[model samples]
Target: MSRLKLPHNPKLLSHWEGWENATVYSTEGNSVLVQTVDMITPILDDPYDFGQVVAANAISDIYTMGCLPELALNIIAFPCSVLPKVVLSQILAGGQDKAEEAGVLIGGGHTVEDDELKYGMVVTGFGTKDNLWRVGGAKNGDVLILTKPIGTGIISTALKAGEATLETINIVAESMKKLNNLPVLLKNHKIKINACTDVTGFGLMVHALSLINKSKLGIKIVAREIPIFKKANELALSGFVPGGAYRNQEWASPRVIINATPAKMPFDPILLFDPQTSGGLLVAVEEKNAELLLNILKEAGFSATSIIGSLVVDKEERIEII
Candidate 1:
């Protein structure tokens, strides 16, 4: 896609050129528009729950940019002939409810017939350039805060193998369905977010690397402080790791350097490379205000939030796990 000869638009923000979501300036230039489209296959059995997860995952990109999603269009592909109409209705209803929860309107959508079921949305949001967050603004000595726990990928893989218990499945589903609305909370505190990105399919290591690319800085992640799901590590060690996890490890291993080896830990490395669904927002803020920002997040009900890492002026590597 990058090689295709396309006309250049100067209004597009170059800082976000390689970013997952696209940010473009409006004609009036008073506000910037953030647009992103994402779709995911069913990770759970219930269509309604799947809808909720997909909607949350899709809108997460906009939220990562510190913008509020206002409009969305559903993108769905389902096997209508094999499934009941009620199933489709339930899925659509679930997506609508989640969108409404985010204060977004699902005005219209498009659907197509397919053998495998898939669902997601194309979301649009608005924000001023001064408030917009991108993947590349982390400064040295900035503390990194993760808004949620990791390990959704391993849990989903366990579900597919019938190795995950009902309680575990419910926990993972609930996390995936939870919206990353941290931007709203940050607004009230007036904290300066230096950089921000949502942990998604690329896993934490890869996503964190994106924050420090060519910035003459590196991220030092405290592995012990990183949060994981209840049984996610056990499942990952038992070979319930998803294929995407391995892919993430392969892509990030060279750029990542682990200083301290965890003792008697099984699949400890997988936690850093575990692909996530609707994961939390990883924000970089000045070390001075890190605690206040974290407190605000916890007060807002984000109990899993943690200061997992910080940015350093390391020239050799992009990430150092210790």
Candidate 2:
């Protein structure tokens, strides 16, 4: 993005300066329009499941910005000569179902023939200017919360190696298909969220660094408090780690500091750097409202949600993992 000579638009909001998604104020200045596009190839065997996960992943960017998805356009690539037409239909059906679940309409899209199959979406949504959530609003006394467990990258590597059990594959698939819809929960409980972002191609550490860096503060994470998928640690230890995990670690090496590690931990610290697909939202809320927000998420069936860490006034380093 830095290399590109992008135009200067006065309507662009500064709050979304470093955010992955882009938001602009409407001409009327009453609401803000949020827009984002994402795409990913098949991670699982079932085309339907792959479509569901990809759709969820693409739409998550809007949710991370605290906006409700309203419209989407399908982005597809497939080899018509190699794969049967029915496969494409099932994939579209799956995407449609998931989009509808998020109250978004698939108005139209573009498709093309390619050697390998791929699918995703471009989603748009709207929210009031006053309610816009930025990634830079975390305060010194804010508490960090993650809505989903990590390790999709590890589990995916295991599946490709034919070492993952059917049960494990099922569990990971469901997690990836889950949507990061915290705005609904927050509104229901009348809670105000300070900062938020979804964990995706970038691992938790990288995303956490993005949060604190924007706020010009530091954070301390409780390594053990972080939620992990079943058997993810074991799989990661067995050399099932993805290439993206290594890249993430290398990119965050200079900014992250390891304070301590528990003696009984199963996985190495590298697991903290594992990449994720359709991952959960990392939210920062005032310390006083942290517990109540967590309980609300739990009651709404977000079992993996937990208070992983807190922001500190010290800006010595972007993150400290203990």
Candidate 3:
């Protein structure tokens, strides 16, 4: 839908490609500049939990990019009429608590009467450019790692439809709330990760495309290597997958090819593109120290981590899932 037509009269943009051109970057305290904003309509049944997850997710980019945030501003939009003030308050409180846990300030933000609820934070942090992890450096022989299990989109969709189990919601929320802090932990590791990014709305496939597009590489994943939530695959096959998954496949179709027979893993491709509210980080690291990096991530609390794939130079410019 987005690719075929403008959501509305598309406005002209001025800050086009700001991130791609910046170079010679430096920061106070020798930090690499990292900025990230995250928000989503209130997804959790518990308003407080919603707030906490949104705030933590918004700041995840700083963690993924290898920096400690100095501060952040809240970004939110919601329907006050549809939602009670108490619900709203719980959301804010939860957001504030998440920020406090991360030792960053939410400070303040804007709100509007939106049809749907949305909440998140904008985080600005700093780190050395030398430590900046990017998705363009994925080299052949680099091992790919997923810091958390996939399937937040599917589980949440089921929740919205009143079809998801409480156990599933609890499990998915735990994964979403888990922040990706491997950057700081990987600072002194022997592992050499070539590319990295937080897997969110674009799903593992679309985000991986960014790396393949820039590095002229294709990614290969072992079906058994990719980690998934306990019942996520089950839900997806039961037709509980989210809309974002379809959108992802539609937008990134040219770049991805799923090799598994549809019979073996029916919703695998859909899962690859499902929009994750607060998904995990994917890093392409050299195999020599892949274990060490995974160890550090585990120490940092990414317990479900796994080496999912490898990158290969490809003139075709795509993701080859095997």
Candidate 4:
């Protein structure tokens, strides 16, 4: 369905790279421009919250590429006749506030009438060559760091099923609406990022697997070390898992070797494949800097950040849960 004819140019670094979070173009001055677009249907009950989540989700790709978001254009589809105009205005206002918080300028956008409402953004960011990170450059011995807790998919499912408590709803909403500014924070602290990607619909395991693509490297994740919301585990055990989680498990099962069980929590390990909405960054940093990076994230109020695993030279497997 794509008529995308890729151009052959030396400055276009992401022309042929597949499965990247965003398209990156290098400049003659040793800088790079990143472009990405993403959209999603209503994930929250509040229209404003949904707008915020979508905006954060869309801009995450640019942040994952270690770029500062500079500009954005809105993309909206609304049921103009059915829903009140106030709802649409709130959605735009929410998106605008979130974008402005990221220091991005929303020049303009387009909208069309529809039966259901949808919203997203096309974001462009800028970064220097030295600070740019890619998903394929994870080195052996580099530590894998997850900047946020997992299990948004299960929580949201539980919410829809009327099983989620107010506390749970509040927790997941706060997590999803938060921005992935780790790259910028790390750059300011002079921390080096070897590889990175945002954990989105493909879930953590699939996103982590992308880092080792076409390489002899494999990631070994400590099952207990991976973060998960306690309520999500209970919801998952109660048969509230999303379809995307199962699909992700099926897709990664061939290359993934599970050396660990679901343990006492039964549903804990399964969360590794649970699709997240606006999830955290899966960062790969040098072994020595791993502790400092984790500390920095925590100091900046990212308390759920953890060093879940590390890259290893294992040609037989792409990922291992142990």
Candidate 5:
């Protein structure tokens, strides 16, 4: 599969890491901004309903960077013969509703006829005047905190296949539907976060790798202490993992060692690498105030947040998964 032919271009190779959205490149202080547009025919059947959820997914990167939205654009690819304009309108309505909830305005976008149905958004936002929490900011001894439960990747795949229960599906749905709203809570707190990144397609390790490389440090994680969504383990056992996870494993494996045995692994490494549409904020905060920040997140209703690990020392960015 490594030799599998796929899209090949320097732009894709250079920005393959999620940082394309948050990194800046320029002179004259006119910093570049991050904006993205993505659509999934895989989730097409529920387009009208999933539009809102997916809209949020597209906006999440902006939120993770503490940026406020300025505008949005709708993108669509649908089979004109098979799907009606009415269906497309309803999908737009759903996306509009979610965009408004996030306090963003939808401008205009493009649409084209295709063999399958696809839908998503393009979101643009402004950065904080003096701050941008790039992964490089993470410092040694800082504590790691994750805001949402893991395993939504497995849960979503399960739902698509009708293998998950209403309760399990609902739990995953709620986690996905929630807007994170971390900025509201974070703005009110006096404490500062050294680094922050959203855990998406890369899973925990890939995202953590960015923080590690930027800071030049090693991480010690207590796998048992990490917070995972209900039934995540169950889904992992069933092998309902998404494909993006394997890519992440390949990228992150060299920097880390699986401290736990395969049998003892909390979730499938494949599932761990699954691509998340919109996931939780992975925050690295100063040790002295990590607890205070957790309490703030707790008060804001993200009770699942936890202190899963800490930067141990400057040692080639090795990870002890357990």
Candidate 6:
């Protein structure tokens, strides 16, 4: 949609800004509002778990913008006739619980009868005029840190095909349920983040590419340094890759330069383009602050966080996989 020549307004700070969070000036106030709407079908068999995951996914955009998520409205499409009311209640309860955990309020929402069930929220967050973050803020020699591991897409496909183990499902579920709350956690540390974005449907490759698209900087990703789920690599080797992974690879291959051989990477190269659900934040910080920021993230219980790559200048390719 960013490629589309859509209408634009001066108050829209993030218009046509790829898949980054949207920021707009308040019509009646000086504050900037970060908002996004997202929905997803059931990934987990339990309705409650599905609700929690989707809610986290919905509000993640606000966190990506370095804002506090304060308000949300539930969006539900359910088969009322097919499922009992208790199922619906459980789903709503799950969403409400997750919202409370994120310090957000579910004031109200809209629901419509449908044959298939879908759930999500429209999240609104706030930040000061001077603190808004953008995908294009990466600078030369900036360190790139990923907050969570990749490979959920492949594992999800495996689960659907009955090729995944119970342990794998639980591992991926825990990762998906984890909130990307680094923005809120950073207030105490006072670290300066140069760029930020949540890895989602576009996968890490496309999301990282967005960071340098508007600048002269290029990214060098250390394949071995990247973190992955315990069973994701083995599953990918067995042909459990998702359709989105193939699409992401096809879209990102031309722009990225791959330097590492398949033998050197612990996981399949396709996993680099595996789409994630409620994934972690990919942040760019100055080299001096990189270790400090990484420590802060780990202290906040983001154990999977790792320094995966760095941003560079005077490079012809948009991204280089080393």
Instruction: Return the TM-score for each candidate structure.
Output: 0.95, 0.95, 0.87, 0.95, 0.85, 0.95
Off by over 4 Å in 3: 1-32, 187-190, 262-267
TM-score for candidate 4: 0.95
Model 2, global lDDT: 0.85
Off by over 4 Å in 2: 14-17
Give lDDT per model, in order. Answer: 0.86, 0.85, 0.75, 0.88, 0.72, 0.86
Q: Pick the candidate with the highest lDDT.
A: 4
Compared with the true structure, what per-residue lDDT tens digits does model 3 show for residues 201-311? 778788777777656677887767778888888788889877778988899888777777766454456787778877888888889878888888787878889998887
| Model 4 residue pairs with clashes | none
Show the lowest summed lDDT stretch of 10 residues, model 2: 14-23
Worst 10 residues of 1 by lDDT: 14-23
lDDT of 6 at 24: 50
Task: Report the error of model 6 at residue 143, Å.
Answer: 0.4
lDDT-better candidate, 1 vs 2: 1
Question: How many backbone clashes are present in model 1?
Answer: 0
lDDT of 6: 0.86
Model 3 root mean square deviation, Cα atoms? 4.9
Candidate 5's error at 75, in angstroms?
1.3
Write the number of the candidate with greater TM-score, choosing between 2 and 5: 2
lDDT comparing candidate 5 with the true structure: 0.72
Give per-residue lDDT, candidate 1, residue 52: 93
lDDT tens readout by residue for model 1, 190-298 = 7888999999999999999989887889998888778788999889889988889899999999999888666623347978899999998899999999999989888
| 35-116 per-residue lDDT for model 6 (tens digits) | 8899887877777877889888988888988888999999999999999999999999988898899999999999999999
- Model 5 per-residue lDDT tens digits across residues 1-322: 4575654553232133545344332222534355556565444245555777777777776776666666899998878899778888888887888888888899988889999778878887665435555656778788998887777777787777788888886666666666765665667667776778777767887877777774568888777666788887787678777777777788878887878766566566565566665678888888999888889888877778888889878667787777
Cα displacement (angstroms), candidate 1, residue 276, comes to 0.7
